[model samples]
Target: MKNLLYFFLLTFTVVHAQDKPNILWITIEDTSPQFIGCYGNKDASTPVIDKLAEQGIRFTNAFSTGTVCSPSRSTIITGVPTFKMGTGNHRSNYPIPDFIHGFPDYLQQQGYYTSNNVKTDYNIANEKDFIKEAWNESSRTASWRGRSKEQPFFSVFNFAESHQSRTMSMSFDWYVKNVWNYLPEDDKIADDAFEMPPFYNDTPEMRKQFARVYNSIKLTDNRIGELLEKLDKDGLRDNTIIFFYADHGEGMPRGKTNGINLGYRVPFIVWFPEKYKHLSPWGEAGSVTDELISFEDLAPTMISLAGGKVPDYLNGRILIGENRSQPKDYLLLSSDRADNGPDLVRTITDGRFVYSRNFMPFMPEMRYIRYIEIADITKHMRSDFKLKKLNTLQEKIFKTRPHEVLYDVENDIWETNNLVYNSEYNAILKKMRNQLDTKVLQARDILFAPEYEIGLISKNQTPYLYRLDDAKYPFQDIYNVASLSGLKSKKTAKEQIKLLKSKNEIVRYWAAVGLMSQNKTTLESFKNKLMVALHDKYPPVAITVAAIVHENFKTEESTQLLKQYCKSDNMDLALMTINYLLYVDDKAPFIETIKKVHDMPNRNYNVKAGCMDFLGILNIVENTSKTEN
Candidate 1:
């Protein structure tokens, strides 16, 4: 009787597993909804993706929590925002709690076979083990085909044809040979056929390069069609649900790493087979929903679909199925350091208006990030800037940005206008600012601390857990000081000057940054305070104050301070110091110091990159180490 009872239990488990729907995710890299045909772009040739939208529900408002790939992928896998995880900086690989497994682990526990083929750039320490635990099979050929008979599956296929490399960074000849060469003649996009965005110069060189965006996407669409065809042939089409979306925004120069809507918005569609049609919260086939969904919502939503309990630690709401939570009123997005470029921006969007607070307002939107600076598009734009061929609007990319910017993406699709100071949008601006502040503090955002500090903290505890200790992080105080950055007023400067004496080093660091954001005239009155802060115990505070003094007063004392810190053994501090040297009035005095740091063995990538940038600006090419590691 006991043996017979065990057999019955095994039968029930198999049947229950077979009843669950198989989920297939088709993720393309670096694409925005504006570039897709389903999103009303006449120039796009994404017929397969548009057809998928017609067969399912199209999400009109979908965003990536982060603008870049690795950090965005980290959020998707964990259902945690980058700011909270301390993974906002690209490729930082900061340690997270060992118990914090990817959401797919929950699906695996529920007897679903998971596979990823095969992009696993999750941007957290111990990523190899994390990926290993999440997927039954994760390789170039990983798929549902490897799962047991009658078992449900969650399979992800990442397409790279529309990635940044194919779109802009790679040589045009390589694009033609690789992406365009495989396209059918009729599907090929013509250079003249595409309309150029107003922000870019309309010269032949620009048009020829921009046209790659269209053709590369067309190739991506073709691949999606082939995959759909294979799914039908495999006889799983009847029970499989298909999700099609991109990792982040477009891979173009101003789109991928930016904090605006163009950088975070993605093309998202979910197709439910007849077996799982009842599970979709959005209506039937061909429906479009404007519900605000971000990458953070994906993990819990997927776990909910797989019949697993959503953990409380996952902040994202269950976006679909019976457990679907209420839609978000606003989404908080972040953009941080991407490849040796230091910046911090927090953005909020209500599916129509987008607001961004540029904490590092001194750097232009198109700052000299080493990875992008080497791209052909960036080089071309730089040449155009030097020739003064670009219009005022086009040249704005290289200029310092406003402290705050608001855009009505519904009306201004290109985001050419700033509505932050406009009287009519004052209420909206205030609402967004308040919402951003509340959300950041609620999450106890750890990215506000310098990466150097995060590294030190991570040595003792994971940043995810470290942030929860209010006494250690003192986030409210730090946030209060950080929020003062870019508010151009003597009153704000006075407040920052007073806070420079805060006992907390992080708070003092932010206070110094606030003073740095002020105009030279306003800083003149606070010169004494700034000078004293240049010797503050915290290296970041001293480095920031040094930048202010070097830029305005050109004091020899401040110059020497910056030079000394540039060679500090602490790479993060060294990176901070070298970055400040890039903007100062006198680059000559720092040349030798930068060169010495540049030639230092085993230097941090950001520090070495900054040194190279400083030397490059002076047109001084020096012998440097070849490898970043």
Candidate 2:
């Protein structure tokens, strides 16, 4: 009788699990909404994705937390923003708290089998273990088919057909074989089929390269169609909630790594089957919602759908189900260092307008990021620039950006015009600016702490927790000093110079950045103060001051200091010093110093890449590093 009772209990448990809804996430890489038919792009040929939007809920305003792949995926996996986790930089591998694992761990606790079809670039220090704990199976062949009979499963199939390489980076011949050839003749996009974005020059060479965007997305759509067919073939279509979306924005030159809407916005759709239609917060079939959603919201929403408890550490809102939170007023987006490029930019978008603060105004939107710089399209643009073929607007990518920029993205899809200086929109800009400040302070954003300092603190404690300690972070003090970075005026210069005497090294570091951002005339007046700061105890501060003195005053002393740190044992410091040297007009003095660092054994790849870029620009040698974008 006891054996019979145990058998009955096990049967009941399995039956209960079968009643739960299955969740399927169909994710594509490096795509933007502007290139999709559902988003009103006439030139797009994405029939499968458009069908999902037609039969499901199409989100009009969705965004990624970060611009690049790993950082953005890091936020999607953990229900927290990269800024708060100290994982804002691309592929930084910073450690978070032990209690914080992937959100799928919650679903598993709720008796659901979880599978990820082999793309776990979570960007955490303990990635392998994290994946093992989060999913029942995570491999190319892993699937929900492996689950027990009648047990509900949550599976993610990530398609990389639309990644940056196929879209732009790889050679055209490779693209033809991999992407274009896969599409039907009718689906294949002609070179002149689509209108190019105004940002790029409208030459035939440019158009030929731009066609990859359309063809690659079409091939990705074909893959999506195949997966949907399998779901129906298995007779699980009615029981599964299908989610179709891209990892971030388009993989185009400026779209992938930039902080603007073109980089952060993504295509998001949720198709609720008849059985799970009640879970839709917005209506049932073929509904369109203008609600603001971000990558940070994915974890909590998925956990909520699985009928699991959402951890307090997960700050994202539950987007669907009975626990659906109210819509957000605005979304905060961030972009940090990617590959050999070092930048810090934060943006706030309220669905219609985008306001950006370029903390590192010294770097251009199209700076010498080795990953993008080596691309054929980038080479084409650079060639046009050298030949004086590009207009002023096209040339803007190569120049330093302003401290702040505002755009009515609704009206200006290309985001070419700046509204920050417009008197008519001053009130709107001020409100958005204040919102960003409040959000950053409340989150205790760890990215405000330099990457080198984050490394130092992570040795003793995780940067995620270290940011919360007011005594250790002093975020307000650091933020105030950093905010004065790009303001070039008498008052601002005087204030930054005074902050150079602060006890905090980070504060002094920003002060040096502020002084460096000033014009040559302003820097000349403060030469004495800068000369003292050039020998700052903090290597980062010294490096910034060195760049200023060497560039403006043409002093060898400052260049010598920069060159010494180029070979510093600290790779972060070495990378920092090398980036500044890349901007200097004369590369003769630092040639040997750069080559030595590049030849150093076991040097950081990014540092070596930076040195390699410098040498390549001077016709010394081509960069041969096999580092992935």
Candidate 3:
């Protein structure tokens, strides 16, 4: 019996050794395949990526489940669609400690030491479960060698170089300043050569803005080269299976952090020295397959390769080796919240066609601020509403979208042409719509249900109630309210006043947010309630109220409220006070607030930048007025 058991154990070990592969996933931020040479970009000089393609396989039609960082990463890590995980929106604050079972945890169970090099944007229940070793705080190169060699490992190295808001440190300013240097001068800076994507007008300034974006990409590619060189030098290249992909598309108008195909469709390349000879079912080295795959497939693929059992909760399928399945008939993508507002958009795409469902069809496709940031011409164009020579890209960015949209991707690579109304494509649209309906039903999407119950249940009362079924508004429920819906509603005003007096901190904060959106009498009532809320044990509520008052009101009362809160021990609240002061053009007061909070512990850099930016905007506005005078 002992001999028979030993033989069986040996056999099992041999099989497991053959099945497991060391996984090294390199996820880059804000990139698309269209810019890479392997994906047919003639201008991009991504030699490292092209070399990887020469060794492994390149996916022609890889898609991200969502466009934004959190949702896309969540979908990839959880191996589930964003809608299924109840995390389709960015504002759905991930409740920690649940451990929603990621691929890394599965691999750990299989005895692989899993580690991530920064970038844990997974809307996971508990971040600790996903990243057992907090290697993200350190450099990627150092993190790679931090692991033990005894255990075959799964390492994720995320490069942030491609991220938008390109830094001056990287010499990326050249791309923005010298757009004509890269492209031909004859290439009409304002003409059809620069295809103005739908929702954008055809303007010269918009064209110039796109040139800056292209420059940022160039800088990102340089960083990729550095990382790849480091991997080769560490002698990890031979055994490691390196897979490169982007979190989402470039943060440009219509694309970037939104849920358009331009936003979600990204570059994907895999390179494994041992497995390089064995072609993926799609093709051999440097071959690009037009298979429809989403980020959701990533987790399952990694799990399967690591010889780990794929979880039942995952909707993703493994797409490697003998088990490689054909691409799905359609891929689903969704976006809910990013920055300050809610944008609920759903997209279904086959290889040839794309169908979109804009839940908030009335809202303009592009945010005004984002548009101005990307295209300088947009800033000029906005000043003259009657200007008829609006660029196509500008038009696409500013225009209101229809409820449903259909595009022939085969012909319209830029997605400028909408074919939803064309009779010829009615059947195709109907088929895709039916597919979405069936999938949503199968997934048991809660959005389809008539009632969505929110709020808490306590020992005494049944808890608070907010019936979303009747609310009709899709995205507004998630924000601070003051940012979108101005202070105007009487009912919400009354509710805010009542809630500000609540014993619970959570309820009080939400109420304060509501109050920030009400009229004068309600505002006064809100202020009184805030005085009581400020004294409450909860620091966040006090800080939030102080910020709201400073942002909305410019009176002496608002200034006093801010001054009081700026003295709080909570650095976050103090920062908020400073930010609010900055927003209301009270620069002197803002500087004083900042000076007080300068030494406060745990002050967020982004908050500080927001304050600075606001100050800069004030100066710019002031200077422009002076020049005009």
- State which candidate, 2 or 3, has the greater TM-score: 2
Query: Which residue segments of model 3 deviate by more than 4 Å?
Result: 1-19, 96-99, 133-142, 167-208, 274-276, 368-389, 446-629
List the candidate 1 regions with Cα displacement exceeding 4 Å.
1-12, 620-629
Tens digits of per-residue lDDT for model 1 on 1-629?
Answer: 99999778766765788989999999999999989999999989988999999999999899999989999999999998999889999888799987677988999878798999999899999888899999998999998899878988999999999999899987888998999899989999998997898999988888888999999999999999998898999999999999999999999988989999999999999999998899888999999999999999999999998898888888788887878899889999999988778889999999999999999887888877766765677777877776677899899988888988999999998899999879999899999999999988898999999988998998888999999998898899998889888888999999999999999999998888877678899888888878888889888888888888999998999888888988888888898888777766578888888888899897978888888777765652121122111
Task: Give the top-scoring candidate (TM-score).
Answer: 2
Report model 2's TM-score to 2 decimal places. 0.96
TM-score of candidate 1 relative to the true fold: 0.95
| Highest lDDT model number | 1
In the predicted model 1, the residue pairs found to clash are none
Choose 1 or 3, whichever is better by lDDT: 1
RMSD vs true structure, all candidates: 3.9, 3.6, 9.1
lDDT of 3: 0.59
Candidates ranked by lDDT, best first? 1, 2, 3
lDDT of each: 0.88, 0.88, 0.59
lDDT of 3 by residue, 371-394 (tens): 123334434444333343455554
Can you tell me which runs of candidate 2 are displaced by over 4 Å? Answer: 1-13, 620-629
For candidate 2, lDDT tens digit of each residue in 328-386? 99988999988878888889999999999988888788877777766789888877776
